[model samples]
Target: MEKSPDAFRTISEAAEELDVPQHVLRFWETRFSQIKPMKRAGGRRYYRPADVELLKGIRSLLYREGYTIRGVQKILKEDGASYVAGVGRGEIEPRKREGEMASAPPPGMSKPAPRVKGAKGEAAPAAEAPAQPLLPLGEVRVVVNRLSENHADMLRAALRDLGDARRILDPSQGR
Candidate 1:
C-alpha cells in the first residue's frame, strides 16, 4: 500500500521524492540549518512533511534555477524558512507561471535571469516563478502563446528582448 504524501518520509523517501541523491540530501542537511529531520535510535533520518518541502525549494533554486548554494542560503536567511517553504510549495511563483517552463535542459544549458526592475525604478518581479524550469526558450514560448489580443505587439517586443538577453547570457556563447 502507498503511504500518504503527508506522512513523514525516510531519507530515501525524501531523496526519491525530491529527485536528488541520498548523499545530496545529507550534504544539504550540513549546509542548510533549517532541514532538521527526526532521528531514531540508530541515527536514521525521518523527514517531516515540512522538511521535505524545504528540500524541494532548495533543490529548485540550486539545480533548476541556477542559484549558487550561497545565494540560496542568503534567500533563506533574509526571507526566513517560511519564505523558502513557500517557494518549495509553489506558493511564491516569482517567474514564468507554472506549466510554462520545461522540466529540464541539457547539461550545457543555462538559466535566464528571473528578476528585473521596472522603468519607474521599482523592482519588477520576473514574469512569475518557474514551476518547471528547464531552458530559456521554453519560457519565451510561453510568453508567445499567452499574448493577449490587445498586447500581442507588445508581447512580441518583450519576447524579442528576452531572446537578445538570453543570447548575451548563454554560457557557451561566443561573439
Candidate 2:
C-alpha cells in the first residue's frame, strides 16, 4: 500500500524520494540546522513533509544549482526554511551569483535594490531580497540562460581588451 503525500516518511523512504543516499540525509541534518526529523526509539528517523521539502530544496541548491554548502546555509539563514521549501516545489527561483548581471533591463522596467535590516534596525542596501519576486522554474531557467549568455559575452569582451593591452605592452608578442 502507498502512503498519502502528507504522510511522514522514514529515512529510507525519504532518501529514495529525494534520490539521495540515507547517509547523505544524515549528513545534511548535521550541516543544516533547519532539518529536524522526528526521532523515535533507537534513534529511528521520520521526516515530516516540510522537512522533506526543505531537504529537497537543499539538494537542488547543492547538486542542480551548484551551490556550495555554505551558500545554501547562508540562503537558509537569510530566507528561512519556508523559502527553501518553495524552491523545492519550484515556486521560488534561486538568486544569481555576484558578477552574473543581465545584459539589460527590459524597456520601461527597473528593479530597485533589496533592503536588509541594518545594525540599528534600519533598512539597508542588500544585493538579494524583495527586489525581485519569487519566480517559477520556467522563468528562473529563462533568466539563468540569459545571464549565462551575457556572462559569456562579457568574458569575451574582457579577453579581447586584455589581448589588446598585452599587445600594446609587448608588440613582439602581438597576435
Candidate 3:
C-alpha cells in the first residue's frame, strides 16, 4: 500500500512513485553517491523528500533525457543538487547539444553560465581541482561470445565490476 506523498518513504515506495523497479533505485545509489538516504538500524533505507526529488531528476536525466550516468554526475557536481532536482520539478532543463532534444528550461531558471575559455579556446580551470594522474595502459585483448543486446545492462555492470577489480589490483591506477 502507498503512503501519503508528503511523508518520508521507503525504497519500495520511492520506486513505485518514480515508476521504476526497486533494483534500479538500488543501482542508482551505487552509481551516484550524492543520494544519501537515512538508514535505520537494520539497514532499511528511508528517503527524505529531497532525496526523492533528486532521484526523480536523476531518473528523468537518464531514462527520459538520455543522459549517461557520468554526464548526470558532472551536472550534479558543477550545477549543484538543487539545479538537478529542479529538472524533476520541471523548473530546469538539462542543456541538450547537437543531435539531442531541444526543450528549454522554464523562465528564470535559465541555463547556467557557459564555461569561460582562454585565448586558445581551452576552458578556464576549476577553482580547486584534484590531481588527475593518468594510468599507464597496456593492451590485453579478451574475446566474449554471444553478448546480445538484451543483456547490455548486465554487460555494462560486469564491465564496471571488472574495471573496479582492475583499479584495486593494479597499484598504478591511483584511484
Residue range 54-154, candidate 1, lDDT tens digits: 99898887766766688788888888777777888889853322322333342347465344556777766667534655554534554434334645665
lDDT string for model 3 (1-175, tens) is 7567678989988998899998999899999888998999999999999999999899888877767798888888888889888998889977773331233332345555567566678886878445656443433333344444534445566666777888889888767
Model 1, runs deviating above 4 Å? 95-175
Q: How big is the positional error of residue 159 in model 3, measured in Å on the Cα after superposition?
A: 25
Count clashing residue pairs per candidate.
6, 0, 0
Order the numbered candidates by lDDT, best leading.
2, 3, 1
- Best TM-score among the predictions, by candidate number: 2
Off by over 4 Å in 3: 1-4, 98-175
lDDT-best of 1 and 2: 2
Ranking by TM-score: 2, 1, 3
TM-score of 2: 0.57
